[model samples]
Target: MRWSAGWHGSAGSDRRPAGGRTVPGLREVWTCGWPEARVRAVGDGPVALAVIGECGADDAQLRDALPVVRAEGWRALTRWPGSYLVIARSGETLAVIGDLAGQHPVYYRTDAAGTWWSTAASALAALDGAPVDVTALAAHLAFGQPDVLAERSLFRDVQRVPGGHLLLVGPGGVAVEPYEPAAYAPVGLREQAPVVRAALAEAVAARIDDRPVSADLAGLDSTTLACLAAQRGPVAAVTFADERLRDDDLAFAARTAATVPGLAHHPVPGAPGTVYYAGLDDLPGLPLTDAPNAYVVTASIKRAVLDTVAGNTPGPGVHFTGAAGDAVLSAPSSYLADLLRERRHRRAWQHALGHARLRHTSSFAVLSRARPASRVDLAGAWWQTAAELRRPVRDWIPQAQRPLAWTPLLASADWMTPDVRGLLADAVDEAAGALSDAPARLSDWSDRQDLARVGANTSGWRALALAGHGIELAAPFLDNEVIRACLAVPADERGAPGQYKPLLDAAFTGTGVLPGFVLARSTKGGFNALAYAGLRDNAPVLRELLGPSSHLAALGLVTEQPVADALARAAAGQPTAQGALHLVVAAEVWLRQLAAAPATWWEEVSGRVAAA
Candidate 1:
């Protein structure tokens, strides 16, 4: 019975199917067997709200805004990394809201009985909604698809409220509208750092309330958060390392921990985070997530976090690490492009040189990339749709928060043999169109790309869900306030290749949370060596996972044999695209899950839920 709930009249209990029924006050009867949810009732009036996850502005923060909600008739409490639900009741009206970045997703539908909503997709879909969304499944499996695909959900009948939007579920039925991400007016460069420092500190401070906590120190987000956490009191800091990977994650953590007086840095010996095949055969829930690497790392990462927290830190501690630091902080290569657009040549060139130096690449490469229409890549064009500036697309982008490119992510379609690719011939095109339709800027496509990062939905909510069970984990960098602050600073100030996220560097160094040397240090570690070896070790599992009747191929989204050949080549020591391969492995695993789901709970629900 691992869950978090605060209900009066003892309506609070485990989420297991065997638990008690009805919360007395809630509109819909919740019937499911998931323990990873938090339900808390707050405020006294006809208006009420209850969230099912540990993400939201702190209780006091929400309480302070009550006056405003009453005056305005509606309010969404928090924005950054806050997956919150604000349900307001006035007369027969019910307003349900989700966070700005889809972290705490809210979905709902209306019928003769009024409207119902929740964070869990299937929970609501089971009650009433459309059948499986195959195109969404294909788009999801398409690597590099926009991480946050507007309001579309796995169930066509179940629509989600956008991150910056609100859903009014009332006697009048459902109506959706946008609210947050209020226009950001950039400040002068001199004012940037101080604002960043204040916002970063506030975000970090909000998460450090009294619970014993552990922080990460490998990258800028982790190091800064951990350092700031230390300023308040003693906190355990951690990073992972092993001989196989060149990334000196542990060494970096150790050095920084030594500099900060109250910080305790623990170097956790690395385990094979998991080869693409780690869960090759696993398919957990129905209408599985569209998030990238979700099947690949979600459970393993959760296991690692829980294990680390349980093993060393005393009495259930919350784990905090950098999650959306790159997306939130790194300006797209487009900032320089925007400068070029404005004809600010001198400043653009200066930033370009600095960025080129950071990547250890050429200024030409930076210039070419920065210019949105610089290259017309034919191989991967998801759409011929010109961006807002009518520039051409960027080419193949292999990993997290990359600016939108023309091609489907490399591994997005690679898993299927040619036959399967043809079967789902429009897969890549549909995916590209879907992503392109979302409003984005050339200067911050990567920021929009945050929707798909591994840290976005699955990982954060998993941790939030676990919070109810006394295993609290936090990523202060993902705080809404931190996101707002970063948005205020010009993207160019921090988006250069070598100087990516300089604001973070300057924030800590300026505040003395980290040394000047740390701020000046350019390179961060990479772990390709470890990933390759892990992939090799897990070859057998992968081979079995991709046998003749793969669900992906059966669904006409992938062909089986090419994947088999790829596994063999990877095993034979040929050049491997590790990033793309991970997507293939994970997507296949999800297809397996979707295939297997019907036999279990989904089978019962899928049949009843009709198509749109």
Candidate 2:
């Protein structure tokens, strides 16, 4: 498509509230920016309501769930959740509803005039003119992953809107069902610690709507949503610190702002603000065209942590963040699939030999890495690839069996070049046919497949890049009633290991809420020296944004001498070339900002739908 885009609104709706109740053929658009989304339309009454990114309640819960989704269509659109998008229209029959961890992401395209969805998949792939496949951007630059379990979208007719389904278009065409978290039983640990302490105290009191918030005290689900958002009202917390790393979580966020109460910690500091990664050569801007999180953080560390949390938060607040609570509270041995579904084959080999002596490894490398389709076949050929050069035939083509779901620790494809490793193994065999090469290893099937591969991430694109700087990020652990009360414990007691998220340490130590020196510390901190010092302070603007007029090296989809030998083996840190140099510099900075985005851009809106 095209590029150069920003600030476009009006999915149309609004006008008729001077005594309220207008309903005639609905079209209620609303986006006073600061990252807002509210497009409603359903007067001939079928269904339409929106609440894209962060949500708990938006305008009287879409005026009390728009008459239960125009009276039960696609089952009242999964009641409500943190990330959302719902559209139902009755004529021409359009339907779409994605929540339950599809994380405010819908992205559609049917055409001939009917289904055109949003949640900005490259601005609906430049309003459906759609193009740029480059072999699904070489399968998301080698077995992609940035919006998990792949529904495909490097654009070749854009699509996505899979997590717990529901996308029906009509005229007898496109369809997809399955509403909320269809199921999750087995609740123990004394009734799953008071339903995860009253669903994380009503998901930190509905984003402390009483205003001022900043949260994130480096883990323990942002120190239990900053001690339950400082029990309501004024909170700041934050924490980054760098000091050229070694250990920094701002000393457990200054001992969680010296024991909560009206919070106020802040921290940030790490050389010129979260190490501003220096002018990343016109750093992928133009509102990150086709952004599935255009390179997950580093536009000078997301403009220095959004100018240190919107310049030390005061007005227009809420920053929270626990970032999808480590794939919805930990995974590894998927708690030996809940001790072999309670038949307890010798207590699932003694909980996979106590997670192989607390990760020293080998209890059969912790039961074939507790095979959840072998970590979704190496997260579809790698994005999170660091476990000491992740393996897939380790060293290259060796595995005998039990790991075939997705094995690409690149024994070959030798960090890509022979035609970018056969277009990244045909985009990791089309994201291994969208997973499940044998999944059913129960016990919150590793937190139900790590909450459907945590799509829309890096803390939901750092809350949509702090809504172009005005801030509003809340993540009281991805609330849908705090992840259905942290899936009622048991996925091996929420992956123990010094209890960082052991059901957020047994739901705030059975609700005392903190103490045990901020939930028994035991390491859960990181800032990574501002991304290992932005690979030597933006090494020549990431070598001219992956040089040689890099449109992913003019469509061979990357091969400029393996991008200077994977940036000299990720500048020597070598955690598999520093996670393949952030998946090849965030896939050449999102194909150089989706080829400078602009297929038909628009943006001009100001306060309360231009006040009538």
Candidate 3:
């Protein structure tokens, strides 16, 4: 529920401003859940700089850099070690910069009086009592891509500052401008390994303070972070082990903890209540997020682990999770399309053969999908995808079996009403029309989109942890410097076949921070058993939640009968539309919570003009 808000324009209000700081241009800023230590400011009056979050810079450094950032643009403010939001003011101009990931997204609503901005879209939405944007929500459920409606928020009239972009409010007006490119010049993985290692180390170090530290030790990504955290001091390493999860994660976790110093292993045994959708009945207990959060569906399991950490560590502390590790370190097999587009026929064929073997399909089949994608640019692919979405709903096909494109349509598209699909298609078409400067390669766009999707969801997870347990969730992989270092390497090398996260392996191998066994292990784990169990056990509640009065059904976004059918399939142990159903349920919960939320996001100021 932490947020910061401000506005730039005339000061018409007679009432004194609430407890907040005021700058030039009659602007006022207010923040909540931000300690004085987390808030740093430099300069005064017309020229000032404020940073809020875990920034790894002292006041002296910020003071030295203020002039440079004021003379130049806000891009110069992003080179700091840790993740933070920068608010800069010079004369009548103000710039608000969020991280490259959507973790600290910036949202605003502009009108005649002024432009109001905040870190929470929900807060801004509450200012004017704006309703949810059905088309934007449809696009979110259908694509799971953050940038489909790049400028639109889930709430009507509330605009989102797109990832890697800054919000600038000046005497002229408000504008969203990009401070970072969609892709970088390709660097070899070998050359970028040290950079990756250093960035990740710094990211971990940034979160290490007097607070107790803990991290997930489930997979290589989390394990790497846990080991890295251990390098600084003692870490309360947690492993969620259940008899039903037929994986070696717990075994590997125990081995790593036994070998590594300063890692106290805590094995949390899963119970019947510790399953997905286990706590959906109590919607009021769930923390309100800015958007539909995937974490809501799996909050039971997450809370179980958090409860364990809270037991070990008494008070507020930092908990790290390997949320976006896969998105950053490993590119999808679609990188084969990039290889083909670059005229590397031999490398493309070799990669296709390797991928085909892993997928148990023919090499020609893999290349067939890649060839078409290689010929299509981002806008072209979006146009083609819109055309396909506008057609008749197709049968349920596994996502892996679907044809590769710039953005692959998920099974959730089938669950939406035709009218909603049309709306979503139109939105996608409009977005495609606006992408005049999109990334050239499919991998570049997809990689960034994937990171954004994960980052947004993890923000929800952070909210949940903070509200429920007073713990701050950190995802080192999503840090600005780490992303810059890892993504500079070509996607093809990062996602090479027969290898698991080659980028991470290259970065940490022989570094002595991660164990050799962890670097060598390739088998990953899943939660299929728990997901099915949760569906079976919570079927009655889920049915009622998505029943006749579902908000999504009222909005024509999702058809009730198809979702009910999907639930039945899940109960019957069929290859059901689990992922799509998860999206539907998350959206449903979010809509309900939004309806019940109180409009207490802003401070009371007399005679303030309402947003237009």
Candidate 4:
């Protein structure tokens, strides 16, 4: 990688620079000591392309991926997983894009002369000419982080490329287009499930080769992949040790790997990392805008784990992950359905009920022992009371005057379907012709879409951490062909054989590398208990970071005393709604980071204005 402009590039090889200093028009490129072939790029004309981080996938795997990049040129291809950014020079134009899902945060800005560029957005504000967006600060105070909406960034002009999107900066102006999730006709469940399984097996085998590979070693996804690969070659599996945050995963990984013949299992310490939870770029004594929590700390923790794993071993091997498999293959509609069905939790249900004013009576109340009349009151909280309590004035004119909005996210699938499908009756059928476009209920369609994206998104985040170590991580389940085939499968077959990722499991069922129980296990490990415990253990930091801020109290929607009392109760082992709220507070720390950044940085990034 080349460093152009005024950017100074340094990593472990260079001494640390003093804090709070700023650089202007500097470009630096750093990569972990992965093979040079691992970071190859090709483009001509006005292109300045960089393919850094962990993208090499063995010779055969490279053969599969290279054709896509070569054919599409610099456009974002759908199948690439892990933490990555592709900056391409097409003709006289420049475009930098991240993977379909945000595995890592990408920050960029157009210069004063309007030439666009991207760098790690995390600390870009520390650079010269970056602007700050205070309204993003307010939104961060309200929503915890700023990327909840598409094209909005903490710094005004710096924007995030939405998942399944490409950002093109050309003389014609900036154009963002969705990649990976091409529209395809839906197919029947039985036929599609097997196809997904076959495509994924092929993708995994192509990348892993005959060498040993690594798996995260948990339930469903990783275990299944390890088993499949074992049929073709020896494999290694790793998991976090029995620490506060990784206790359940350690046991699950060990147990699963035990069944894989000739597979080695490595359990490394997985502790909460210690870093700038709110902003890694913040200088000492400069307050952060959001809470810095254990997850950020995980970055360092992951690096240490991988380093130890590599030192114990000899050469590099493909690392397999279940990443984003949930988003790409599983249904999130269950959570939404649970809210609608469990009529007793009105406040909780408000968060899941479809947009206010569209509530409908369903059989869920009868299914859950709550009466229909009681459920009606639950609707009031989500529909009328909650909105009025949160804000009297609508943020904008009511939806009645707005273009009907549509997103393919399926909140709940258990209940409500045909009713919801009516909302998107006029949507384009891109996923048609090749597959069965059966007029399924809207709920089923939503569930399918969620499953398709979650796996890629989740794996992408893990891949980001691996990138720091320069390890190429791949998720066979995230292969576009696998996803497209899964899309062809019927809903029942999608979750068949009593397994959540049945198609994925079935793809490896004959491999004989995984234990029968590992493949058949239905229960998922719950990580929330440990995470909440950690939060309670660190209550002092939480209070110090959030208590002084009047952002929540000023809204008047929530009483300050109750919020404070709840935190106290949680710290004393009494977990409540307040504990979950703290997660939001932790995210707020990052928002504050963006809000307080230099104004010039914000202006060069997201193209927004703010209050002083």
Best by TM-score: 3
2 or 4, greater by lDDT:
2
What lDDT is reached at residue 288 by model 1? 50
lDDT digits (tens) for residues 1-612 of candidate 3: 767778777754322223444532335766667767777778755678888888887789988887876685678888787778888888888889999888878999987888888888877787778889999998888888888789999989999998889999888899999999988999999999999999989999989999999999999999999999999999999999988898999999999999999999999899999888989999998998888999999999999999999998868799989988988888888998888898999999998998999889999999987788899898898899899888999888678777788888877788788898898899889998988568999988988899899888998999899989999898989888888998998888898887999888999988899889999998988999999999999999999888898899899887887888889999988888788888889999999998876535655566555432
lDDT of 2 by residue, 392-475 (tens): 313322322224223224221344455555555545555545554323444443454455444444434654455467566666
- Which portions of model 2 show Cα errors greater than 4 Å? 1-63, 67-81, 87-92, 97-102, 107-132, 135-152, 155-203, 207-216, 219-248, 261-455, 459-555, 567-580, 585-612
Best by lDDT: 3
TM-scores of all models?
Answer: 0.79, 0.31, 0.96, 0.61
Q: What lDDT does candidate 1 reach at residue 251? A: 68
Candidate 3 global CA lDDT score: 0.86
Q: Candidate 2, after superposition: displacement of residue 509 in Å?
A: 30
Q: What TM-score should be assigned to candidate 3?
A: 0.96
Runs in model 3 lying further than 4 Å from the true structure: 12-27, 607-612
Root-mean-square deviation (CA) per prediction: 6.2, 24.1, 2.1, 11.4
Model 3 Cα displacement at 279 (Å)? 0.5
